[model samples]
Target chain A: MTTEVLTTTGAPLLQVRDLQVTFTTPRGRVRAVDSLAFTVEAGRTLGIVGESGSGKSVTSLAVMGLHRDAEVGGSIALAGQELTALSEKELSRLRGRKMAMIFQDPLSSLHPYYTVGEQIAEHYRVHFRSGRAAARRRAVDMLGEVGIPEPARRAGEYPHQFSGGMRQRAMIAMALACEPELLIADEPTTALDVTVQAQILELIARLQQERGLGVVMITHDLGVVARVAHEVLVMYGGRAAEQAPVDALFADPAHPYTRGLLDSLPRLDDSDDEPLRAIPGSPPSLREPAPGCAFAPRCAQAAAGTAQDRARCADVRPALEPYRSPDRLVACHFAGVPADAAGRTPANVPVPGPATVRPQGTDPDQEVSR
Target chain B: MTTLKPAAGPAPAPADGSAPPLVSVRDLTMTFPGKRSATGRRGAPVRAVDGISFDLAAGETLGLVGESGCGKSTTGRMLVRLLEPTSGSITFDGRDVTHLSQGALRPLRRHLQMVFQDPHSSLNPRQTVARIISDPLLVQGWAAGDARRRAAELMDLVGLIPEHIDRYPHEFSGGQAQRIGIARSLATSPRLVVADEPVSALDVSVQAQIVNLMERLRRELGLAYVFIAHDLSVVKRVSDRVAVMYLGRIVEIGDKKSLYEDPQHPYTRALLSAVPLPDPAAERRRERITLLGDPPSPAAPPPGCSFHPRCPKAQPLCKTERPALTVAAAGPATREVACHFPGD
Candidate 1:
């Protein structure tokens, strides 16, 4: 994976600060992303995790400068250069070469009529200013680069001819064709099956390492975040709920929403007797200007506290502040999980199986379970 | 009404072993006509479901899970006679309902209800919440006034505002719409409900709400369910017993604890491995088995063992011999596996 990127020390590869994105729908002004801030360094994956309507996808689109009907404000910098101020033509020039994005549905992203190889070749030629024959070679190489078997033959086939996983691989191959320094994958593996999802995640991680590309992964699945993310920023109502290292966040989530999310998900290892402790209410509507904390209504701690605690939480929006460690951020006024007691919980370990579980190849059990 | 007798005839059986299973499926198969090509030649018939069998005791939950086109949805449909099985029998409390005529099946519709994957699409867009919820009751010979009253009661039961019964589906959020779908499924107080990926469309937080609601309903009503989904973790959360499907066959079926903790069939193991666990440490330590390729086309399935093509533990014998479903020789005798070399 030969590539060229600005290899500067001290500064991060991609910097986003106070990024706000709003849509003017018939209903009202919907602030999809509300002053969300995060950054990604080269060779690292920053996962932006949130549920539907949390503005995770909108953040990715704003970075790519792809929002047409929405207003985007604040700063998005790549390689120390601001992107929000760039013109459409200027951004287009930087898109395939400097930064690129992959979406959830590969079929919709890939053109149906054109052969997969020809599309990749066209994209490569447009960005690199190369001849068709030379670009075609690069396209086939990329197909092979993403681990698609029979790259040459498959390149000649259309998107419809390829399977779901192969189509996604082709999309990744095309996205990395110009060797972008920054990659924003918005729910890239959401549409894929779990097995294929693992393969794609491994491919991206490998490519990120070899090319030293900064990656921002957006998804609702915590498992995907756990697998690939070095740092995670959990979003709620288009605002930052919590931010920390992957292991630390999962070990002891500071935000109530994050805690509720972890509680809601049914772990494979947990006994069946325990009913899922789902959060009582649904996510807040972002159509209106939400006063105070958007999550106060659903926050269990706020509800259980005294009248003053509840009033404070409902009357004032909690700013994203450092939670114990400077690196960790939580946006709840009453965020729990004290730093002194942040022990690595055995919640990460699965209950051991009996000796007679799998005798044929007992080793696989160690890989899947604790 | 005359149509209510068939469904009411069966005395509610005890969930214990003292009575037979409420629902017993044996070698159920479904084959659809092949698609005709531009050249006017038809392709091979698709065996969406091929000889799969299971039993669901009263109030029991059977989780049917597989990847896309593995026939989990098709199996769920067949249980409620949505799509008639091409072969084999579906016995409901010792009564064979497989080949029953539509006229004869009318009463049984009250006993078995279906909650679809997409909440919005399954419901009528033109109808109000009241109309949507009362449709089943109306079909079961209830008067309009009585059904409407029942609809309002159901709204409150499913955690929806009773006043909102006059509102349209679009007015409600995704989670609320799903609640309406659950409310409709329970309109006639069904004995067995087949929920085909009911919560897959909603957000993670909202998914918890739906799962909790279903669990509460199941406990209160003593209802049996065939929970169909692709997510293994969610299946493990709700199921008493689970069946792993591959290329239209039940490769493995057993008690949820044993099967998930120690999967017998190679495909089941691989399927379980594919699921991404939420904990980062567990994810880092756990080994994953990536299957070679996508599941083969059901239209032209592979010879002998269907999973042999991508199976990690597949042997040459798997290529020639189609293993029949049999009781496990070691460990749990209740577990049934179809692979020649089952346990690792």
Candidate 2:
């Protein structure tokens, strides 16, 4: 049966609120994503930045309704239509029609045996119920739109024959063949070289402007986000550590984790020989999270703070709320506190001893056992 | 930084007005046979590395930056003797080790080592951390007990707790595992370390930790590094001098500051422009030189200049004649660039 899809006036193209994804493993129930919320308007990009196991990919999968075995709880809306309440068939109809996704590696994503043109044509045929010749012609047009030279000749080649960059372009072409209004690209440029990455990003930007498509760009590289994203969301330990407009996030990061991430990156423009301020501890395990704030144990400010402030950090979980600016949100107990007032200690500052002692229970092995 | 005594050897005669470099490579080339074409005939050989030359001084870092398939990895592999070069001369510590057999190269192997890209696969999953870190010493015929002790020390040096030395590589995170790889590479106190994209696979925070540790190790132990990576920013932080490779050839080589601030070659400029700065203000304001197409295939590189097809400022001369690596007239003579039109 067709589901009633409502279109709200002035609503975002995609809206996610209080999203949580929990996976049932043999060991226990693991929380892959926790309370992730964001919105993407037409022709704008919202970048979800995080390291491995921070739930960025899981969030995307949950949005796409691809998490078959996981327990997904939250509100995900596309053009004001509630997606979590829809049936599998209804979701499938919307997946490649109203929304599309491209992954990190195009080699595995594209079919090896079929011709590139045939694959794109099939993608189009399934969605639009078009004739084979018409679908083929559309595929060729798409290939040319993506800047592939001699589209008709190249479309006959198999996935194996295409180069890495060309293969990615073909994937992009297939994704955009139906002209979806929303696109989710998970680490699309991670596998590509710098030059090719620039080209692919440029292509996606140009297409987004042309189609007015809402794009969700997922990557661990902050540089990528700075270049293309209008807004940024920083994820840590399966939660949004910080979220703000790209300019605000870079200029005045509220969360200590966000500050640490930015400070750690080696800048090409900076010629300083000083050592980088690396975040002290590894990421926490999702199976059993720490007591209060997930980042507290490794945060230098938390370590060096007054006893009362440190106790509050260890006992109370901070909610994602406005910090410094109305648009900026941070999940830290002392989000807007100045560095000196918060007792912030410089990272990588040499301890006056043989070797610095690691904070208790911060080790990955210890966390796994606990 | 404490000064460590140089390894004992007959110091070679001063070359080019200074002490001879610790490792010198000249005219290095590596070609791999390509697959057969549709006509059932073998295709041309892929020139993975083509006549590239460089020198690494003691305790210095020479960064090799390039995109995928640009022979940066191949060049790193050749330096550590992991792969045999089709043609080249590799001089190490005043001795030519280019043609040395495996048996003959054993003694000199202690002076050269490599840290691979993937920490997960580079390390043996089944082996204990101690065994993994001490493998070099064990190969060199060190006693098992001594090797274990040395491995413990190395763990401490790389910031891993000594108690976890008995754990497997699977027990550690990506960054920790990379540290184990670094510790293993330094087990024999090699004069030169070829790190192939060592930090690329790690998280940004963890990457800084590893970079700091490597920098500290370079000062403490006086180890030379040939840091190869695709990230220009990371390379700039750790390298004294940088080399830009494109289509199996070095397009530019100069001091890190000079090359980054005043890049001569168009390819080098394009590469620098392509890197997205973390600062949004600068990134938005930056004038990006978007290259048109992917780099030409290494196996069938374009005639004359391989980059001529994509170069924005390409001329007829670039399409007909390949430019040799030559010193630019305006800059320091040591700053060499392989471009017909050297400057903007």
* Two-chain DockQ for each candidate model: 0.33, 0.58
The segments of candidate 1 whose C-alpha lies over 4 angstroms from its true place after superposition are: A1-5, A337-370, B1-18
Model 2 residue B247 lDDT score: 93
DockQ of 1: 0.33
Specify the highest-lDDT model's number: 2
The candidate maximizing TM-score is 2
DockQ category of candidate 2: medium
Compose the digit string of candidate 2's lDDT tens values, residues A144-178: 99989999999999999898899999999999999
* Highest-DockQ candidate: 2
User: In each prediction, how many residue pairs overlap at the backbone (N, C-alpha, C within less than 3 A)?
Assistant: 5, 0
Residues A1-370 of candidate 1 have per-residue lDDT tens digits of 3233355345578899999998999878889998888989888999999987788989999999999899999999887789999999999999988888999999998988899999999999999899999999999999999998889999999999998989889999999999898899989988887778878898999999888989999999998999999999999889999999998899989998999899889888788687787776667778754577887766666655545555677788999999879899999887874312213233322222322122332111011110
Q: What is the C-alpha lDDT profile of model 1 across B60-141, one tens digit per residue?
A: 8899998888999999999899889999999986889998988999988888999988888888989999999999999999
